[model samples]
Target: MHKSDYIVKYLANSTSDYVTSAQLGDFLSSSTRTVLRYIREIQAESNEHGFEIISNKGQGYRLIIRDKAAFQNYLSNSLAEHEKSDLNKLECQIARQLLLTDYIKLDDLAQQFNYSRSSISRITSAVASIFEGYNLELESKAHQGFSVQGSEINIRHCINNLIFNSFTMYQTARMLQVDDLDWNSFKKAATDIVKSRGLNFKQELLIQFMKYCYIAVNRIRNKRYVNFEQIKDLEFDIVSDESLTLMLELIQLICPEFEKTTESQWELYYLALAWEQSIYPVEKLHDPNPERIKFFLDIVEKAVENIKNYYGIDFTKDHQFLKDLAEHISICYWKYLLNVESENLYLDEVRSKYPTAYYYSVEIAACINESTKTKIPDDELSLITLHFAAKIERENRKQIKTIILCSTEFGITELLKSRLNKQYGDIDVIGICTCDNKVQLCHDNADFYISADQIEQSELNGKPILQLSPFLDEEDCHLLDEFIARLNTTVPLQSICEPNHFYILNKPAKKAHLLNYLCDYLLQEGRITEKEKADIFAREALVPTAIAPHVAMPHCIIQGSSFLVFAVLPKSIIWDQTRINLIILGCFHEGDNQIKNLLKQLYTVISNKQQVDKIIGCKSYDEFIKVMNDFVGEELC
Candidate 1:
């Protein structure tokens, strides 16, 4: 059954009222025309069930069902049939094979599967499109036949996606008939290996490593091995003899038959790669190579400079911050050289929740990538962001101004204030206003109000009021912490941008030319120095600031003054490597964490494809600003 059939059944069964095509399209992340096409298909499929889609022209669509039980039954049977289809299984198999193997002959595949050459060709063609998204190509040579052409790293990325995404890891392993003992043996060996190396493997990382090892073991057992000689030797540090001994022990421990395996080095290197990506505890900062340490420090040094320049937050003085960030960068560099992939569960959440910290990490990531010439994966990028997020959280702790509104009866107010200071080290208690004289409370610098009495909602005076027990229990502490986080809301993006900062460009230009043009305008307007323009290009070279498909926020840190520059090309202008219709250049001063939330808002506004389309179509600068203001202004902190 088509996906649209399921959607149609859902709509028809759930609603008696008219469901608009736009609503369906939005839910499916599809278009109205596509929804209509699906509706038509559903109508044809629903012939037996007497299902119909009635259109109400301007208002939208309604699902009309006759004999509801019959429709539900048809939907269930069709879905079951779709799931069990041989074609779906074959597609998964072909994709898995393409990802793991070097080359496959169409005729040989046809003969093996007992299918026609034409059928195999069609399957291979369909799988090729999937590989293309990862910058890989399916090419057929005269003698070699069909193979996925890309860098080994990219090929692994494609394979990882195929394995985890196309089917569950357990299911894929089951399909290969991999023994359960092999996985258990792999985990036991992994535990021993990490224990010996003083490294820790979180559950998420362990799962990924196990999957990779399973795939490698299956491939090796089938005589399909990655040739170590063909693999390029990367220059960096290598594991110690003790670690190598542990790896050899790990390989031998997987199975008694593993000792007879011809490709032992490949397996050893796989372990090495895993070890390189594993999280190293701060206590295990033992690098024998001083030069490598210096190399990483130099990268860190530059990153600190860029962060200080761009966001105005100087991390150099934060000793713990420097230590944590340095360790992360070192591992990141090693991972890059060895083509190791790191997984972080918090990547998406960090990107959304801590956009400011994530922004700095992006800057740091770009700098590292520029110097090292390797792309940082999103998970790894988020790991880097975590360090900055921690630092920012520390800074924010000092910035939060709290007020306690407790009466001086039995000296419980003083006791509560001291507990507040002890329980929440981040908050700053500015005043201790009595509950009876709530009107005397300070509202100007206060971020949160804590009271022992039942303060009415109206008495909050727009401030967040946390009602607490006089003794300060666990629940009250939790509530206070939650309220304190709300203090992060700062000045809006529109307030940050002035009339002169907005620009509308008509001429077509490439990314570099346009960047230079924008910088030239900034320089002429005396908003930025020539040196700052060079810094923007330098930052751009490290990472294209295109945060979304249509919007790119290219920015740099400059001395003295900061400017929020917004530009709309309306025409497709090359941004970084992609084409962008809008660019917001954030020229920031030192110690500026305020822009972090603004970037978050900018991303939220840009992520809406419909809103972006409307903004891009604006004819005048005033119209464009109005659209941007309406979108970002109301939501700004």
Candidate 2:
């Protein structure tokens, strides 16, 4: 469950005074707006329950239980009966069955799940696409059933993945159509195996291993054993004594059919490698091949180096990063060789929430793909993106160095500095100067200049100057904040987006019409040539750059001065499957570093739904600027 649901349950069981959103937010370490959103969701959920949330304007919010018995009963049955028949669950079930058994018929699935053959067929079609990611295919024979055709290792990956996903063997077995199993015997065998080897594995992996052993035994009993001869060309070295005895005992106790063949040794080696990577810690691995280990480490270090050079994030010295990536890549390389697809849970969330990092990860994945000559799946790419996102989020709290230039009377500069410090704790005001300060001192290692008096571009030796009022009111503070937003970065978004560049379109139009309209505007303004406009469409054809849900940032590096052209279509226009109301077409030259930064910043802004809401509500360019300013202030601060 999400924290929002936890907060709702807490509120429902509150014993104190009415809880304010502020108190709830503070308790949860979240924003009050987020708390209110959770409360609103809880209120919606209460529509079917016996609990209702009542908000008292001044006092705060109170959870009023209409019927205590009914509310308790609702909570009791919520977990077990919550959405039992979703398409995603059905897909998982079908995939689980395919991974467990050699062949499954549609009629058998239809009878088992109480669904029509057509419905099962549609589900199997989706499952086929998923299997295709692992380089596996669903094949149908003339008089036989359907089977997932793949290498032995890939099939094992699919089976273990299914077991790893569901919490218990009982739940997974139900999905796999395994009935009347001896649970006591399975558990005892797993316990005995772990005890004999003295291996400390997580309870989940213990259950998963038991399930794997059971499935392997059952498949062998049905004369459907996996063929290990296909991978005979590949060499492997086992590095654990525990793995040797464990595999021997498991095969002797469960699948005694192949105890004397090379298949048993291959299965033992691969299973031991899997255990060391997945269940066991990296440090526990006994003397692996040094060259193979260094190869994986080199890939990680080079990827981090490329990320630092490309996006300016120095995760090279981050030891935890090196360890995490090294360990993941070790398993990743094995999966790549075996053509096993990882089932990433946070794929969509990471893609939407941290798209900049996701994009950077794709670039990094491309480098790995070229170097290794292996196709990395999108799920694996998302996992890599998560590490980058975490590193960026960790470094986001660093101070932004600034030099404040104020020409006001005595103590006024100090007061403005204090206010600035309070408003933005992330800003480090290294020096406060008057208008008559030395030019070299103003440029002394500071990122940017914020001055009360208007400074010329040449005054600070090419440093960007943010002109602000002496008193530093809200508008002045926001104006000064634009510099802080891009202080550490190469681009200032306000510099790219001018007041003349914004256009609000209330009329309905297609993407082509909108693009042509913007291109015509640029042509009339002499911002781009006709060929550059055509190049925009050419770039769009290559990849529809809908960076967010309702935002599309389509850009091309053509022969022109950089221009950030924005079109706010509040009524919405169709782009792919998403409804885009904000279109930012960036026209830049062949080499413009700030344009990339501007695109990244725009992605950051549009990733936030609240910021998009504020942007869509804007009726004028000034309000749009304010929204941008507010977003920068909130985010940077």
RMSD, each candidate, Å?
Answer: 12.9, 11.1
Pairs with backbone N, CA or C atoms under 3 Å apart (clashes), candidate 1? 312-590, 312-591, 313-591, 490-637
How well is each residue in 346-394 modelled by candidate 2, as lDDT tens digits? 4546766575577556555555554564445545667877877887776
All candidates: TM-score: 0.50, 0.51
- Each model's C-alpha lDDT? 0.65, 0.64
What are the clash counts of all predictions, listed in order? 4, 0
Off by over 4 Å in 2: 1-193, 196-205, 215-245, 258-270, 277-292, 301-430, 433-599, 610-637
Residue-by-residue lDDT tens digits, candidate 1, 23-103: 675454333434554665565456677677666756666676787788778777777767534575576578677665667
Consecutive 10-residue window with the lowest summed lDDT within model 1: 226-235
